[model samples]
Structures are given as C-alpha cells and as structure tokens.
Target: MSARHFLSLMDCTFQELQSLIRRGIELKDLRNRGVVFEPLKNRVLGMLFEKASTRTRLSFEAGMIQLGGQAIFLSPRDTQLGRGEPIGDAAIVMSRMLDGMMIRTFAHSTLTTFAAHSRVPVINGLSDDLHPCQLLADMQTFVEQRGSIAGKTVAWIGDGNNVCNSYIEAAVQFDFQLRVACPEGFEPNPVFVERAAGRLSIVRDPREAVAGAHLVSTDVWTSMGQEQEADQRLALFHPYQVTRALLDQAAPEVLFMHCLPAHRGEEISLDLLDDPRAVAWDQAENRLHVQKALLEFLIDPAYQHA
Candidate 1:
C-alpha cells in the first residue's frame, strides 16, 4: 500500500493505521536514543500553507529534517497559487519538482483536488474539516501510555470541530468507545458522526459522557475564524470545560489531552493540563515521529520500512 497522501482517517484501513502507529512508536524510540536513519535521503517535500499554523508547520518541517529530507515552505503570498492559479495546476507543478506535498489549508475539497491531480503523494497537514495527522499522533500516544486502546473510552468535551472529528474516526479505527459532549446545537458534523455511528456515543451532558472514560480530550471553545463568537461560545461551553471537578467524573486513571495552543482557563483548567496524568506534551512530541514515519512511507524508494 502506498502512503503518499494522508487525506483523512476514513481513507485508511484499520491495518494501515496500525502499521503507521507501530512505525511511529519505533521511530520515536529510535530518535530518543539519538539513532538516525536516512530513509528519505535527498528527497524534497513541498509545503504549501494557505492557512496559518504553529504545530503543523514546525512538526512536518522538523520531521523531514530528522529523516534526511528537505522541505520548502510556500505561503499564500509566496506562490502563484495566490494569483488565481487553480489548486490542481499548482499541485501538478509542485509534484514534478518535489518528492511529496504537505498542504495546510481551508477546504478538504482543495486537498482532495490536489491529491487527485498530483503525481506525488499529498499529505493533509490540516484542513478546516479534518486533522488526520493530529489523530495519528493522538492514537500513538494512547497506545504508548496504556499498552492498547481498544475498548477504552475517550471523552471529548468541547466544540465538534476538526479535532473532535478526527477523534471519532480514530475511535472507529481502533474499536474504542468514544463519547462526545457538546451543547445541544454544537454536536459534531452529522455526516461524520453518522458514518461512524454505532461505534460512537453523543451526549449533551459533559459529566455523563465523561463518566467512566479512560481519556478526556478537549479543544478550544472558539476556533480560528470563530473568534467572532468568543463571548457567546464562552458562555455556551462553560459547563463543558475539563475542570478538576469534571475530571473526577471519569475513571480514576483518566488522563487529560488537548491539541495545544490551549486557552489556559477556557476549554481546560490549568490544574488539569499540568496534572501528572496529562500526556499533552508526549502528544506534541509524537507529532514529529509519526510525521517522519509518514514521510518515509511516502517517499522512500526502497520499501524496507517506514
């Protein structure tokens, strides 16, 4: 199987994701011991970011460097893509010049178009609709901490945004129990939820959804363009915040997680984020390892290992 583009969790099979996670775990261990591999020696990754980022840009670039590959960053202002060039044309041209492409943008359709048109594999760095790479890191972290994630419950207690969408996909892939707690009208995208139905539980009450869960995850109450609704969302999501009191509602060993750039006292409490049970930093670090595995799987000429 080719690992060219990582579009969405739904695009991968359970076995494919297992291979990715396993490779990521091994790469992480090797990197920690100062071991180095040149699987993508001389390969170049073209990075296109129409949207702004912190983790996605740094992690992918860092991962490429660690794997003996190079990356070129092209922001919206730096490319023809800014001047009415079709996404398909841009992707086609980039593919011919680079070994792979990592795009962080708005629409999922744009990346889909890029993948459909490009000769090289296209990785979805992030899109408004999904964040599969983040989920890869998250899945690996879960396994690293708990041995195995199957059947364990993970509670999502915030906006039904991209992060929540990715978590739902991960739950289905691993056969784990996923419970999402959002305000009445703030539930996850119905299409994704329906696609993973039977394997997911949607709840209106944060406490009820979190009860008995092994992991508690949350994201910002107001995401990037949603800052206009900050005051309103703050009021709506107040009860959904992962506080010390709410943490008590989950299984005793429950751990807290967040895709960082955290809002100290909003979606999660400072205490819970700093708690010994929080593996947030590990999750951050895994982003680099999993990204390296993904690049190797996509660009390495010899299919020896990812």
Candidate 2:
C-alpha cells in the first residue's frame, strides 16, 4: 500500500478524521489515568523545520518520546536541504532512514515535493497554505470542552492565513458552519471558500459573524515571513480583534481559541487569555495528545485501526 501523507485536512476522509479525534481523546484519557501505551516503540520520526517554532517543536518531539519513539529535529542550518539540496533528494534519503517525517516550512509546494519523493508517511507540521496539525489539536480541544462540533457555528475573526484556511477545511470534515470576518483583501483562498460552498460565509463585520457562534477563533495578524507587512496588517485587522465584547456576542457557552505565541494586544485583547471563555491553553496542550495520536496512526501498524 502507498504511504499516507497528511499535508492537508482534505487528505483524510471525514470518517478517518473523526476516528483520529476519538482516538486522540482516548489517548489523553489514558495518559491521565496513568495507563502506559507505547505503540510507536522503536519507531523514529524526523522533523525538518524551515521555520522556527515553539509548540510545534515541543509537542511533536515530546509526543514521540511519550509514545516510546524518538524524534530527530532538523533545521535548515543543520541539514543539506537548507544548503541547496533538492527537496526530492533529501526526502528520498530521509525517508529511507526514518519511519515518518514531519516538515514545518514556508511554502506548501515544499511539502508536496518532499512528500512526492518520500517512501514513508509525510506530515505537514505547517505551511503557508495550511496548518492542518494545529487544526487537529483545535478540533480535539473543541470536542473535549463542548462535545461534538457538528451542526455548530464557528467564527474566524482575523487574517485569512494558514490557520483560517485549515479552519475552512475543518468546517467540511467536522460538519460545522464557518463564519469568517476578514478584511476584503485578507479573505481566505478563493478556492477553499468555493470548496466549502454552503458551509462557509465571509463577512466584513466581526460582530455579525460571532453572533450565536459556538466557537470563536483568530490568529496573529502578521504570520512568519511577513514582518514587513505588520504595520499594514494591524491597521486592517484592528476591527477584527477577538475582545471580551466580541466573545459575549457569541453563544452563552461560546469558547475562544488562538493558536499561540499571541501578541497580547493585537488579534486578541491583552486580558482575553485569562477570561473563562478563552480555551487557548487547553487547545495548546491538546497539541501533545492529538499529535501523539497522529504519530501512532501513521507509524504503528497494529494501532492504525485503533
């Protein structure tokens, strides 16, 4: 059988994605109950990062170790691929040695090229076009805190960046309505919007989108490699910030989320993280459990169906 690659949420069937989330919750519960499950014992995962990370690095590395597997972290400065080695050649070499590979890079095409040549499962840690792994954790978080997200409404109140793009895909896989409030020029990729058809609505007013939403999510106005555009983004995105008032506009039980390393006063209010409605920390921690589940599914043959 050909190896599976999780470069986007679209890579997996809805049923498969739901199965993964269920398994992730089980894993989290197991860990909480002091159950020792290490299906990935003796396996190795290689992580290649072209961009710097905190949660992505810590979660994947620690998750592997917790699963009784080892993870090798490779940065551009440490690998030949950083020094002009072709992605295909590097993927071929790395896949021969590792059980699987996860890459956090800038371009989506970089991930596609590497996965094309890889012999083992390839995971997309993050890319300019999508951050599927983060969505896994986010979905898991919502499931844990709010039960099934199906038939619910989710609000996206910031840039139409990678995280927003992934949320668009998540709306389809998880069966939810997505209301996106972004600046005119900052709308999510047109193709993704079209793909989501009846499931998504793009609006200019954050309050309109958040009203009655079950969940509210936003990301930094300026993502990596876009430092030069920070000033411009802030001006355009100021009205879209997920402040306390905005959270109140959502459902009474609405939960707030932000993929972290948050700028305190930018996309979110400085005090929002401390608000009872914001589940950012829980969402952040779920990255470990959900990713552990992902690794088990990809590397442990016996655990693939579990």
Candidate 3:
C-alpha cells in the first residue's frame, strides 16, 4: 500500500479530520491524567527545516518523545539539501531510515516532489502555500473551547499568507463560514478562493468581516523570507489589524487566535494576547496534542481501525 501523506488538510476526508481533532482532545486529556500512551514506540521521524521556527520545532519534537519515538532535527547546515542536494534525493535517502518525514520549507513544490519519492509518509509542517498542521491545532483549540465549529462564522483578518490559505482550505473541510478581510493586493490565492466560493468571502473592511463572527484569526503581516517587504506590508496591512474594538464587532463570546511569535501591535493589538477573548496560548499548546494525533494517524497500525 502507498504511504499516506499529510501535505494538506485536503489529503484527509472530513470524517478523518474531525476524528483527528477528537483524538487530539482525548490525547490531551490522557496526558493530563498521567497516562502513558506510546503507540509510535521505536519509530523515528526526520524533521527538515529550511525555514526557522519555534512552536513548530518544539511541538513536533516534544510530541514525538512523549509517544516513545525519536525525532531528528535537520537544519540547512546539518544536511546536504542546503548544499544543493535535490529534494527527491534527500527524500529517498531519509525515508529509507525514518518512519516518517516532516518538512518546514518555502516552496510547496518541494513537499510534493519529496512525497512522490518518499517510501514513508511525508508531512508538511509548513510551506509557502499552506500550514495544514497548524490548522489541525487551531481546529482542536476551537473545539475544546467553543464546541463544534461546523456552523460557526470565522473571521480572518490580515495578510492572505500561508496560514490564511490553510484556513481557506479549512473552511471547505470543516464546514464553516469564513469572512476574510485583507488588503487588495494581499488577498489569498484565487484558486483557493474559487474552491471555497460560497463558504468564504473577501472584504476590505475588517469591521465588516468581524461583525457577528464567532472566531477571529490572524498571522504576522510579514512571514519568514519576507522581511525585506516588512515596511511595505506594514503600511498595506495596517487597516486589517485585529484590535479589541474590531473583535468587539463580532459575537459577544467571540474568540481570537494567532499562530504565535506574534507581532503584538502590528497584526493584532498589543493587549490582544492577554485579553479574555484571545485563546492564542491554548491554541499554541494544542499544536503538540494535534500533531501527536496526526503522527499516530499516519503511522500507528491501530489507527487503521480507528
């Protein structure tokens, strides 16, 4: 049988995605209760990072250890991939010795190329086009805090970057209504917009998007490798900031989330992280639990029956 890769949320059925979220919640509970569950015992994961990260690195590494598995962290300096090695060659060589591989990189094509040659499952930790793993955790956090997000209204305010693209994908898979507010030139990919036609809408005004929204999310105005464009992005994305007043336009119990390492006063209000409406902390922590469940779904034999 061919290995199941998790390069995008589109890779799984809607039922499978929901199951993973539920299982993530259960895993979190088990961990809190002092339960020891190590389904991936003896397995190894190879993590390749072409981009720098904090939460992505720590969550996957820690989750692997908790599952009685080991994870190898490979930076550009640590691998030949940085020294002009083809992704397919690296995938073939690494997959031979690893149970699975997770890559955080720039081009989306790199992941597709790697997965095509990989014998084991290849997970996209992050790519220039999508961040499916983070969506897993975001969904888990929402479910844990506000119940099923099936029919809720989610407002996305900021640059239509990778995370925004994944949220566009998430809206289709998770059955939510998404209202995106971004600058004219910063809108999400037209392909994703057309794919999510009825389920999503794009607007210029943040107030309009947040009005009656159940949950709100945003990411840094400028992501890694885009530092050179920071000043320009700041001026362009200024109107899309998620402030308390903007969030107030949403439902009374509306929640706010950010895929952290946030630029406090930039994409979001400086006080937003500590506000009662912001669940960024829990959302950040869920990265571990959801990823652990993701690892099991892609690796554990028992998960076939689950």
Candidate 4:
C-alpha cells in the first residue's frame, strides 16, 4: 500500500485534521498528568534538513523520545542527499531503513520528489511553499484556548511567507475565514488564494484585516534565503507589523500568534509576545504535542514495545 504523505494540509480530510488537533490536546494533558503513552516504540523517524532549525528539530526529536521511538537528525553535511544526490534516490534508500521521514528544505519539489519514491510517509517539515507542521501546532493551541476555529476570522499580518501560506491552507482545512494583510509585492501564491475560494482575503492594511478578527498571526519580515532583500522588505513591511494597538482592533478575546523566532521591534512589537493575548509560547510548545499526534497518525498502528 502507498503510504500517506503530509506535504500540505490538503493531503488530509478536514475530519482527520480535527481529530489530530483534539488528539494533540489529549496527549498534552496525558503528558502533564504524568501518564506514559508510547505507541511508537521502536519506530524510527528520519529528519533531513537543508535549512537551519531550532523548534522543529527539538520538538520532533523530543516527541519521538517521549513516544519510545527514536529520531535521527541529518543536516546537509551529514547526508548524500545534500551533496548533489537526487532526492528520489535518497528517499528510496532512506525509506527502506526508516519508518517515516520529515524534510525541511528550500524547494517544495524536493519534498514531492522524495515522497514520490518513498515507501514511508513523507512529512513537510518546512518548505519554500508551506509549513503545514507549524500550522498543526498553531491550530491545536488555538483550539485548546479558544475552542473550535471554525467560522472564526483569522488575520494574517506582515510577509505572506511559508507560514502565512500554511495559514491559507489551514483556513480552508480548518474551516475558518482568513484575512491576509501584507505589503504590495508580498502577497501569497495566487494558486493558494484560488484554492481558498472565498475563505481567504488579501489586503494591504493590517488594521483593516484585523478588524474584529478572532485570531491574528504573522511571521518574519524576511525568511531564510531572503536576506539579500531584508532592507527593502523591512522598508515595505514596517507598517505591517502586528502591534498591541493593531490587535486591539480585533475582537475582545482575540488571540495573537507568531510562529516564533520572532524579530522584536520588526514584524511585531518587542512587547507583543508578553501581552496576555499573545500565545506564542504555548503555540511553540504545542508543536511537540501536535507533531506527536501527527507522527502517530501517519505511522498508524504503532507498537508499544519497550
């Protein structure tokens, strides 16, 4: 049987995604209560990255250990896939040894190509086009604190980068309305907008987008591989930052979120993370929980061997 791949939110049915989010909350509660659940014992996850990571690596590795599974982290220097090997060939070889694989890379095609030739499930850790894994955690955090996101309005401020693109997908999969406020030249991929049908909106003014929003999110003004355009982007995105004042325009119970490694005084106010409405820390921690749910779901029928 062909393995399921999570290259995007569209890969799963809406019901499956919701189940994962709820299961994530249950897993988090179990962990907090000191209950041990290791459904993936002896399973192995191979994580390959062409990009630098802190949260992604830590969360996946720690979650694996906690599940009684093991994860192997491979950097560009540690794998033949980095030194000009074809992604398909690497995936074919790696999938034979690993139960599943997660890849964080530059080109979205790298993930598609890899998954095409692999027997195990291939997950998109981060790609040039989307960051679905992060969205799982973000949605989990929102659901835990504010209940279901269905029919709610979510505002996306600043650069319409990978994380923003994932939000676009999440809006459709999770059944929420999304308003993306970005600079003129920074709009998200048009194909994604088309996929959202009427569920997503793009605007130039952050305030206009955040008006009466239930959830607000933003990412770095400049993402990895875009350092060359940082100054220009900074100038264009300055007015797009998510500030306490800007979020105040949202609903009274609005929740603010950033996919972290936030730039203080840049895409967000330095104190925005400290505000009571900002759930960045909880959002970050949920990465571990949700990803554990994801790992278990994709590699289903996990064993519980010591």
Return whichever of 1 and 4 wins on lDDT: 4
TM-score of each: 0.96, 0.98, 0.98, 0.97
Compute the lDDT for candidate 2.
0.93
lDDT of 3 by residue, 1-306 (tens): 888999999999999999999999999999999999999999999999989989999999999999999999998788897799998998899999999999999999999999999999999999999999999999999998889999999999988889999999999999999999988888998888899959999999999999999999999999999999999999999888888888889999899999988998899888989889999999999999999999999988777635
How do the candidates rank by lDDT, highest first? 3, 2, 4, 1
TM-score of 1: 0.96
Residue pairs in collision within model 4: none
Positional deviation of residue 139's Cα in model 2 after best superposition, in angstroms: 1.0
> What TM-score does candidate 3 reach?
0.98
Candidate 1, residues 225-250, lDDT tens digits: the string is 78799999999999888888888889
Looking at candidate 4, what is the lDDT of residue 204? 90
RMSD of each: 1.5, 0.9, 0.9, 2.2
Candidate 3 — which pairs collide?
Answer: none
Model 4's alpha-carbon lDDT is 0.92
Candidate 1 residue spans exceeding 4 A from truth: 1-3, 304-306
Count residue pairs with overlapping backbones in model 2: 0
Model 1 accuracy (lDDT, Cα): 0.87
- Write model 4 residue lDDT over 1-306, tens digit each, in one string: 899899999998888888888888989999999999988889999999899999999999999888889999997797776588888888899999999999999999999999999999999999999999999999999988989999999999988889988999999898899999987878998889889979998999889999999999999988999999999998999999889999899999999999989999999998999999999999999999999999989875652211
